[model samples]
Target: MDASLLREREAFLRRAKALPVVEKPRAVSNAVNDLGPPPTKRIASSVPSDLRSAELRPALQGKFAVLSSVVKYMKQRHLERDTHPLTVEEILEEARLHDTPQSTIRWLEEEVGLIVVTKE
Candidate 1:
């Protein structure tokens, strides 16, 4: 080996040996810390009876049929235009243009299995 290269290698070894060792930080238990305390039995027992009695309203069922029709129409329009699949935003915009309620749009996306295209 070259004398300069041998000296540089020795220097590197000396510097490495002089460096202080570091210990890894201990892992923290996140469940309790993140969620805070569990709900007390008294809090659980005090939930209102009216909440338990809540049932789906008949009006909502009709909205599903309307949304399905709108989605069908939107699909046909896309097919006619030879455009890419409708995005959630595009669907919502069409709904808004036709005066469909924001809540109805949300219900269609969340509960009625509306498929949306995401940006690639």
Candidate 2:
């Protein structure tokens, strides 16, 4: 390397080293302190205990029984050896054969605890 280049490099390095370092401002916790406490999580009860004791209309009661029978038969036939998750579509199809109303199926699942509908 040339002596002139070496001298210039050393001078530049010395000047760079002498320069003061600037640090980024750190986030202060006091910014969040003014926001107040975090929101409390709400606990939701999925299944109500008093579902069985609830009275149903005569027509609904009959429909529920029909749906229950159909589900029981399907469980025995399709899921005898291994456990199989039943879908709403399959149940609805079977219920259609028995002339069960779509509303009745929804009622059985939502109101009555006879069937559980879970998200896939």
Candidate 3:
């Protein structure tokens, strides 16, 4: 490297400016605490044996149709992988699905016939 180039680089480094100090953001002790307590899940004690799809509200029935599509999608994806059986639990739990309805499990077991909603 040339001595003049090195001297110019050194001079530039000496004259370099710095950004003004900014206060750091307050650290949360627990990030989850900021969100408040997790909402309590409405744990279904038991799904009625005689619950009918038609008995459900129109909007809810539409959601069931969507849920049915999800089950079919899950089943199709599973079938593509291998001949292994896909269950209601897998469909519910798929794609990090947490908000799936409890009654859907029974619907899956009885309506879709994949089972694994509960073990006998």
Candidate 4:
């Protein structure tokens, strides 16, 4: 770190510390602060919770988690069994997503770059 930058940062810290002592603390009100607590009940819900539940939407739920698991499984398999370049089917099976859709699989290939899925 540069000595000038360190001194400037120290000056900034001193200014910040001095603020509380120099000025009288007063309540700064905002809409959220005025509100005591958030409503426990769902206030605006046209969509039901069951429609958004993971049990109903297995393919969309925890996609990043699935990707991470697939990568970890692949790495572990390669380390233990000398496997290379796992197929998407193998990945899906390892992740136990037997009923994952084609579009999501295409996303794993195209958007996430897990593999290149060539058309046969």
Instruction: Indicate the residue-level lDDT of 119 in model 3.
Output: 39
Candidate 3: which stretches are off by over 4 Å? Answer: 1-63, 117-120
lDDT of each: 0.68, 0.65, 0.62, 0.75
lDDT of 4 by residue, 6-27 (tens): 9999999999988866676767
> 95 in model 4: Cα distance from truth in Å?
3.2
Candidate 2 structure lDDT: 0.65
Clashing pairs in 4: none
Predicted structure 3, TM vs. truth = 0.33
Give the Cα error of residue 69 in candidate 3, in Å.
3.0
Measured with C-alpha atoms, the lDDT of residue 55 in candidate 3 is 52
TM-score, one value per model:
0.35, 0.34, 0.33, 0.42
Residue 87 CA error for candidate 4 (Å)? Answer: 1.7
> Candidate 1: global Cα-lDDT?
0.68
Instruction: Give the runs in model 1 whose Cα sits over 4 Å from its true position.
Output: 1-62, 78-83, 95-98
> Which stretch of 10 consecutive residues in model 2 shows the poorest summed lDDT?
51-60
Predicted structure with the largest TM-score when compared to the true one: 4
Q: Which ranking of candidates, highest TM-score first?
A: 4, 1, 2, 3
lDDT of 2 by residue, 11-116 (tens): 9999999999999997777977877999899987565756633334223467657666666766766655745555665665654434556777677677765555
* Poorly placed runs, candidate 4 (over 4 Å): 1-60, 117-120
